[model samples]
Target: MSRRWNPVHPNVTGMLHGGDYNPDQWLDYPHIIDEDFRLMKLASANTFSVNIFGWSAIEPEEGVYRFEWLDSIMDRVAEQGGHIILATPSGARPAWMSEKYPEVLRVEANRVRNLHGVRHNHCFTSPIYRQKTQEMNRKLAERYKEHPALIMWHISNEYGGWCHCDLCQEAFRGWLKNKYDHDLDKLNHAWWTGFWSHRYSSWSQIESPAPHGENQVHGMNLDWQRFVTDQTIDFYQNEIVPLRELTPHIPVTTNFMGNYPHMRPFTGLNYEKFAKHVDVVTWDCYPPWHNDWQSTASLAKDVGFVNDLYRSLKDGQPFLIMECTPSLVNWHEVNKAKRAGMHKLSSIQSIAHGSDSILYFQWRKGRGASEKFHGAVVDHVGHEHTRVFRDVAEVGQVLNQLAPVVGSSMDAKVAIVYDWETDWAIADAQGFGKETKQYAATCQEHYRVFWERGIPVDVITPDKPLDGYKLVIAPMLYMVREGYAAKVESFVHSGGYFVATYATGMVNETDLVNLEGSPGPLKKVLGIWAEEIDTLYPAESRELVMTGGARYEAKDYVELIHLETAEALASFTSDFYKDKPALTVNRLGEGKAFYIASRNETSFQDDLYERLLDELQIGAPFPVQAGKGVSVQVRTDGKTDYVFVMNFTEEQQTVGWPGRSGLANLLTGEHVGEQLELEPYGAVVLSQSRE
Candidate 1:
């Protein structure tokens, strides 16, 4: 059951189709509540998440308890054969609690204690806050452990931010001491504190990085990041102790945040390590679709790459899209509405990767908050006669039609490494020109080539096994941990294709330079020596001239390489390193390893991967040859195949659906022919039974 998409609740089957519902916001308007139930039926949403930020309403006073309102909402959902994802309401503490205990508030990095006005601003290390959260969770579990509507336990909303208070400082020191085996010398060596005489004379001297104090120790910064993540997870584990004890059957999870403003990964905390504590993985996806800087198809590829990353976190298990806006978000610089048919297309795109459900951030928008204008299922108008509401209804209908896609999973033969530790190390590096690092963006660029070709790719961390994948690509892997080089060597020696870009294997886990060479531990496997890395200005670019006479543009970074056992496939055609090897390949055994010594244009990657696709005998998931802006993805339920074909462009696209007869179009309940024509922002789910 864990291999596929496990059901959220036994009573409610099919794709989960509801979102964060805050009935507490409209408690006084009984008519609004009545209309919400009516519209819920119209949208075919069977699940509703309640009490996400309802702490103030649940516990208005320090010791006073109020659950009659929540009880009514739970009973009503059950009466209508729906499910409730009950939240513990720890995302925001009650005003009374904060007023009673000042320690509950977080301390900023500048050592200023916060005045607790916003959500996710509580001290994760505060004993009083932990005690209060456990008490609330226990009370909720005691009341609704056996309730028919109670399905899942949403522990907290978007767990992020860190505290630098005295409590947290003590905890961090303890963590470091434990990691270093209670030896000050080991801590000093690991943190490389001798460089600036910042070595700790006492444990009390070590504190979280600060602007006015200390931030130059890369090792300390890295450890601080790890400590914050551990502390956050430790706190989450504390919140769920009661839920695990009382309602062991209910799955517990907290929604994870995706990339922020400019498609950068959320660097606040490491979700990879935190994902192990939860039963299922879920994330909030809000891509800036149809933006002026990028094409719709390009944006779709980015979303696809991220969805695959989340799906791969659970080993390809069907995860849930906990929160996504139906139209436009109020937080963007320009809140542009979603174009016609895009809502359904984007929703299906999630399912195509490995999502079992497409849920929104809010069921209904609030009236007087910062997010009042944020897109929701029901806007401030309080009716179902809106454009965004109709799009939600349409997505719900499509989810209903493609029920078989639920609990399905994707099997990919390609694996791309996107290690968070490597990213953290790269981000903390003082060199490499801050604007040009773009670690996540580089991985996405490589991933897009495979995505456009409909080649299923698993975005994995550096530690994951590479047993099944034919090709393993690790782009911008600046930090090579212990034994990882041996792992790559063995993988390539055993006839597996390996690809690594520039800036890989430069340093150890402690942020110290690997004296073995520029590529350090990986030099032997990569069959090349990176003598120097040259960072180019934004306006500067070099030409990568292949041996086959194909010229492509290379930019951002260029590595001077001296071959060991590899032969040059491409060379630079400009500057002092003109005609030097820009790309090389080494035949280890039955397979080969390719090293790209510089960053190149997307056109170069597209051409290179297309050739690799044929050489490896890997083809698209579907048999159809799709046109430009058309994306084809596939998922399997172990007995059947579900192919999702979507057109992400503003113009119509066609796909040559060869020899795919008698396949049922699950959305329309019709048989497909040899050719399928898709309109702008259109999508179709084709299901075929296995032999």
Candidate 2:
């Protein structure tokens, strides 16, 4: 199956744009409020998410519900030809509930209950909190079911956090018992609990991983991570099922954090698990705010991967970039401004990948409080005559021209495996180098080669069927859960090329080392077995001498391996492991499986991948003569191809004519010939003739 997704568009008669619009905040200031509509109209925004965090206003006290203010806001948006992504104010517990029912507040890992001032710190497992939010959701759906502006139901704001309180611990024990069939021995053996005499005598003996007592228990930590994720999903399902029954016409969704692999401080959410419950897959994306806006090339690739990953979640359909910034963000250590064209570049990149809509966090900057300084469509200047506003206007104009790409998807023949379990397990196994470095960077290093070559790659999990992808890359995948090794074997044996890098298949799903041999389960399919491993300290380097007379440097770590039924593609030439195989290729059923024993230099990866791709007869999505900081992505309706070429840098660049020449630039309507030049952060969407 190529892809199957049921994408429903509610309240959106056209392309969905706009974002969190808080008219209730300015109910007193009619003059300043009048300008919000004017600015929205200028920006070409059509949707507004209303009443997101108005729980305090919705239900000021127990059993008292208010809706006059929200009713007015809804009617106002309806009159202005805008749709509403009506939100349930469940993300943050109301101050009254937190103060009265203190158990609703989450207890931190340090054993202190969080105060009422913060958002997203609610104990979701609390019955009182659940009852209050249930009533809020029921009332909102009852009132807005007939509202003309109601198109989508936003369940809660970016739901991911954990509560380590006793109540949650009881729930965790219950979860573990149900999963383990109430067999303590099975649970203990799976977690290797007896290694440190930590075996549980009873269900109550199982505790949350956030507590310092079990901080080093890798298996328990992974399970707790999974438990919290399921808890959050269950919470969302409880809210969504009823909303769908009430307002069945409207689609429901919750915003997911795009920094998904690291949203672990709380619920440890895996978007794949949550995607099915929502009508649309949406996430909040913020690239590194550490003042690295020089080119944003690498960050843009991450953006593309996330967008494609979201698209893949619903089986290759369009998703939403629900919350992004038009410019700088306030949460950074030192808030920095996004260079002029960067905002527009980021938005288009999301669209080019697979996003159907672009919505910002807030329409206007907050006047006071923590996020008051955050970037907004309408800045604190009280007017729309600003540089950010102008840049936003340009993006809106471009989006209006992009109605063709509304439901189309980026065509991908390559996929990079992304498993939340592996990602979480790798965090517990972070002593491979001199210091604890994130395994995510190594995963992205593999993604970078294809990204640079304009080759589209989807981020897939082990559960997803690999029927369509010609090539699959799994790097830094340390944990091989049950049945996953079989999945990898099936993909390669079915004539699909596979690549497995260092640290892959070294541990089981339980975070236990494979006692057989390194890459234990996959050793058979991969035809390689590792004897010992060596971690490269900072500044230490090893060389890999390839059979083709090409030499590449391996750094960060090295795995000394001996091949069984595979040929050594390259061998190490350093330390006591001299002449050992560094890279091996095995001829499987009808295809080839390549094993990279260590992290290699970028140039080496690029060179090796180019040869492998050439041998496999795979090519870039499109041919472009653009330089660095330039990227190309292709999407299609299986009839007309949409080609997106973008300049990620702040300097002007030119690209020669593509391989197939009958292309018309969608922006300028110019038939590209010889060369096309783009200004700083310039982007061009072209329609390539399929025939």
Candidate 3:
């Protein structure tokens, strides 16, 4: 089922083309401000996010409010017929507030209080911080609630970090008490504190996981992470009270951060639960494009996978790229500028998945700061003559031309479960090698096949309803939350194709291992039981010989499976467990469930899913044979389908286009032929009217 994309602002139509604008930085220089508006018009940018990280600018001292600077910027935007996404400046507190209210400072896990310096360092449980933020938000809402330029509420700039202060420790205790029904016995059972005689007689003994204190207890660590997420959400809710009261019509959203240092999703907070609090979802996407570690196409699939996950957060609603670098960010180990035409290609690719906007991090580069070298539309020279500016303007033109694609969504028939809780459990597990876990990356490998074949897949959580999906995939699902196994059983029983991988069903939500064999609750439905799992080393490898005489390579991990009602489709051809079942399939009521007992190469997944795709009759949106680096995705209004064909490679490629009659390129207003040639990093948008 395809869900219609909800617009973030009713009055602001078309794709949002602007980004984070810091006009407050230039309040002293009016000439620079004058040039920004001229450049905005030239770039065809319409929306700007303002007041993020502006605590000091808005309030220089305690209660010394300065609304004139903000007022002028809002008025200037309104005068230019642009929208301003006003943000709450609580991400960082002013130095004055930090000095006066030392309680706002966060204490580290080892009990080292942080000095007043960086951002996202405020303690979430501080009542003084919450009160001050609420008061500031109230004033802003009262001033801008009626302003025509105001569009959406940018909650806070990337809400993350944790506070192990005394206040937060007490809050965690209260949270645990409420969760365990105020019973120490239940809490002890859940935490399994009987081991090592760590049973807590009182709540005061329990504290957030600390390196020097209690890091070995998995349950405590898991609960501590959950508590931090809840605490952060609580603080965010406090900041939005005034906005919800004054500007109910405007939607509210906070920019979510993607995974750092690797290709995994952000693990600091569980976005699945936090997504429910926002009216619309938005996130910062800074994939390391053109990196040496991976191919352009391979990295593109990763970006697509994360974008798909973000889109599925709101059930297929179009999300916004709140803060992406237009050129290159200064933070990476090597900050490399985007190649020519890569910006437009990447921007359109975001829209192809489900993004409605292509907003950047900073509109103009900062003069002197940590992010001064970060990419921006206007360089430090402050002109629109640069190559980056031209690329951005080109994207703006394309967005304006593709206005009808706004509020359109993907109709995906497949869903891949990417559970955050499962990821945390797998990472925190004691046995397996941390390098081989790759929970998020493993899911990405499964998704790569679908992405390559142009089959839309919703990267969903385990709890999301599986009613509309024809096929569901769960990779490395080590932790099965309550009732998820039952949900999978019901899905398979109702004629849905279910696929799961190794290291699945090992534990419960609290990192408690299920007793009666592996895949404990799932055994009845899957018709297979795992006796033991062999964790292979980095250089180890094995062969999986299928029953059909096809052989494939397996590595990293393998599970010994005892078939109950299922038949082995493939078996291992090496090691002490030679000829053991490596892959098995079971036929339940109306559907079949397949389990891969070992980690195989991408070739194996490609072969397996190709058969499944044919068996399930799931194909591309249109009958097109896209080249290796070319990708095709579809969005629809039910009466019309917006097809985005993108070339992610550096060479010219020709796609065997789906030459449907009356299908015309939406960007060029020209009809596409049977064979379409795409230049390096090129893209084409076609619209086909179903009516």
Candidate 4:
């Protein structure tokens, strides 16, 4: 018999109805505290994430404790019938700690040791820092073990960034020892240190790799990044393991930065290792302001993909959308407010993709800070009069009315492989590709084709199983880690359709290239030998014509390759490389591997991707209608599926809900027998009660 799939968070079980609540920052304390509870009640919010940035307030001095204020806050929230996801307050260490223990300060890539000012300033490998953080965690856990308000344990806030201190260098050596057993031979082999005379004769000879030194080596600096990630994970485990012993029943987690490029959360810090101590996986998702509708849809799919990855890693336990800005963020140069209905639609999209809870970055607006101007449920005026507040309240009301229809819905048939480690290796490679060859952007382009047609997609990694997906796209797979190529091979050999692009399978786990070919371990399975690579300057492009009479524009990193046992699908039509195969398809065992050798324009990419999907007989969840600014996504629980139709246009635009039969509008409580339409800036959750 298989193991039972436990709910994501057993206590705060149903669709998590909560937002970030920082009452500690308010000076009115008691009066404002009461008002916050009232506002939460009005918004139908039952959960609160507290103590995220309260380290300085809680621990003012060395070994000094001040839980009295927090004690009152927690008790009051519980009295008001709200559940609390208590954070460990390690995100921003107190200024005193940094001043006293300078070792806690982080040294950047340029070897500059930062002074105590910003959050996420401490070095993960600092012994003093780790000890102090662990001490704080123990005290917090011991005090809140049986607290009635406690629902979940939130370990440090958004665990990221790397430190290049001397302590980290020592720690990196130990990490290397454990990984390679202190064998210099294996270490040299893995790093391919021979070409640059970088072979290490002894364990003590190694130093923290930095790109700033006189003899800066990118390969070594990249591995040090991998080292720092492991160190951070170790720090989290130290805190979590002890906390679990005290409160095993309560779930524990740390907020992950979704699709983060640096720190490689997926690889550097082992999710599986941390998942054992964690009950649910949560991430902070902030999409760019300049992104179009397609980008938003792609991001929504990534949120689900990440949740699904965490769920699969944690044995199918649902994950949470820990933090999403309600509206505009502080950083973007021109932060545009999310179009009317887009916020609510995005929330539903999270649920459709496997998020058990929907939470925002902030509940009430900050009076003064870097995020003071950031959008929130309640603005500076502190009332529901603001447009954001009104919109939030409206969403809250809808959530209450259509609770059953919007909660815990899951729908996905195709899964795209997203590996942060592979991304890091490629991005950090000395001479691999251009810095703009972003993994997220590459995968997003492929995902947009499905998202525009309301197709559900799962973003997964190579380690995760590919049992259910009909098509799997792995873009910019630079570093093929251990066993990943085997997994991809197995999936393809079992009659699955796999797609990969340029700069894939170039290196091993340690950034070492496999001399056999560009794809390394995947060469045999992909059936292609890349001989050389060509990088084009901006505005330069090559025309590619498909064998079936489809023409497209291609640019960026183009790989010149020879088909060993594959058929050419498309050929280049420019320069000396004219008529050369630009796209090839190989018959691997019982499956198929499609290889794209150049980055193509979005229109061309969509056409090629759609053609492949058409050939595979994989139908979209809905039909595509001709219209700009209209986006759709499908979410299902294997039976009752929902098609989220949203329009991001200023002018009124009509959108047809394709293949939607016998559907009911979850938002307005109206039933539809066949097709449904949406208006400008209007959104509707069309549910098919019967599959």
Query: Could you tell me the TM-score of candidate 2?
Result: 0.96
Go through the candidates in order and give each one's C-alpha lDDT.
0.88, 0.79, 0.89, 0.72
TM-score pick, better of 2 and 4: 2
Local lDDT at 9 for model 1: 62
- How would you encode candidate 2's per-residue C-alpha lDDT over 1-691 as one tens digit per residue? 2222233453454457899888767877888778887788899888888888888787888888778888877887789888888998887766778778999999988778988877898887888877777777888888889998888889889887789888889999998889889899989888888777888888876778755555477888888888988898887777776687898888888887755322221126877788878878887877752244434676676666666677788777778888888887777656678886788777888888888778888789988898898988899997879988887777788788787667776677788888878777776674565353456556677878888888888877777888888888888778887887788888889998888887778888888889987787888888988877788777888999998888999887888888998899898887887898888999889988989997788988898889888987788767888889798888777767788889887789988764566578776667777578888888988887666
Q: Give the worst 10-residue stretch by lDDT in candidate 1.
A: 1-10
Candidate 3 ranges with C-alpha deviation above 4 Å: 213-215, 658-662
Which whole-number lDDT from 0 to 100 does residue 274 have in model 4?
A: 52
**Cα RMSD for candidates in order:** 1.5, 2.2, 1.2, 3.5
Candidate number of the best lDDT: 3
Clashing pairs in 4: none
Give per-model TM-scores: 0.98, 0.96, 0.98, 0.90
For candidate 3, write residues 116-201 as lDDT tens digits.
99899999999999999999999999999999999899997898889999999999999999988999998898889987898999
Q: Write the per-residue lDDT of candidate 4 for residues 489-590, one digit (tens) a residue.
A: 888889888888888888778777778878888887788978777888787788889999889888777778888888899989887677888998999888
Q: Can you give the lDDT of residue 163 in candidate 1?
A: 93
> For candidate 1, lDDT tens digit of each residue in 542-630?
99999999999989999899999899999999887788899999898778889999999989998888888789888886767877778
